[model samples]
Target: MGGSDSRCLRCGSTKSREVRIFDDPQSLSEAVAASNMPKEIADELEKRISSYNLRLQKPHSAESHSSQHVAAMMDATGDDGQLTLSSLSRSLERMDIHGTTAEKLIGQAEFEGRLIREGQDTWSWLQQSS
Candidate 1:
């Protein structure tokens, strides 16, 4: 531990910082509660919470967890996010990553100006290899 700027509660190790838990409303509320902050600060921070309700939200059932989906991400990313339509979907039995994370990865790839969506479950990197 170089300094006392931060501490890990489990290991009592210094040099760790608090991490925001923003996965869902429940987790977020717990984080906000454990923060031990004042009402004003909590209220203000609540406005900045990032919710992933839409991305993985199923209309009639709870969201699913698919190992196949992680496999798909690994393939599409190829240890990177440059992907092809066939490669991406060949492994995706279901899209179960946190909706926002999936969207962010896709959006980031797209923002780098390369993501191409061919159909509902098809996509590829458009800028070739840079």
Candidate 2:
């Protein structure tokens, strides 16, 4: 409702400002599609919605979300991405993922070359995977 510099609350950006859709998902998706929003914002909304749907449909599918979270963490960790088991455990806990899931996800990431073991309870991101 401000001037040309009005910020979008969802994305905190000034470009492609629009209203939030609170109706059914089908209608909301259609509104998003027809809006003048940026592609990145649209894609992010889609991803978040998809992730939420997946979590609702399959509670045990948290592993998939964990992988995505791990990748995001790696991105934020920079080139020499290094992490400890305790740190990873705490991160997963913050995401509401507990128990052996964190350890399992780290093992899977290492197996997929997304991460590499550096030492006991320590790991590093594999830049080649990015």
lDDT by candidate, in order shown: 0.56, 0.70
Q: Backbone collision count in every prediction? A: 1, 0
Off by over 4 Å in 1: 1-74, 77-100
TM-score of each: 0.26, 0.41
Q: Taking the tens digit of each residue's C-alpha lDDT, what string does model 1 give over 15-99? A: 6665765878998888767577898887766565534444346542332333444355566665544555445544453443343
- Name the TM-score of candidate 1: 0.26
Root-mean-square deviation of candidate 1: 18.6
lDDT of 2 by residue, 26-112 (tens): 987877575768989989988999999887978556757656666545543434567776776666666665445657767887888
Clash pairs of candidate 1?
77-80
Number of the top lDDT candidate? 2
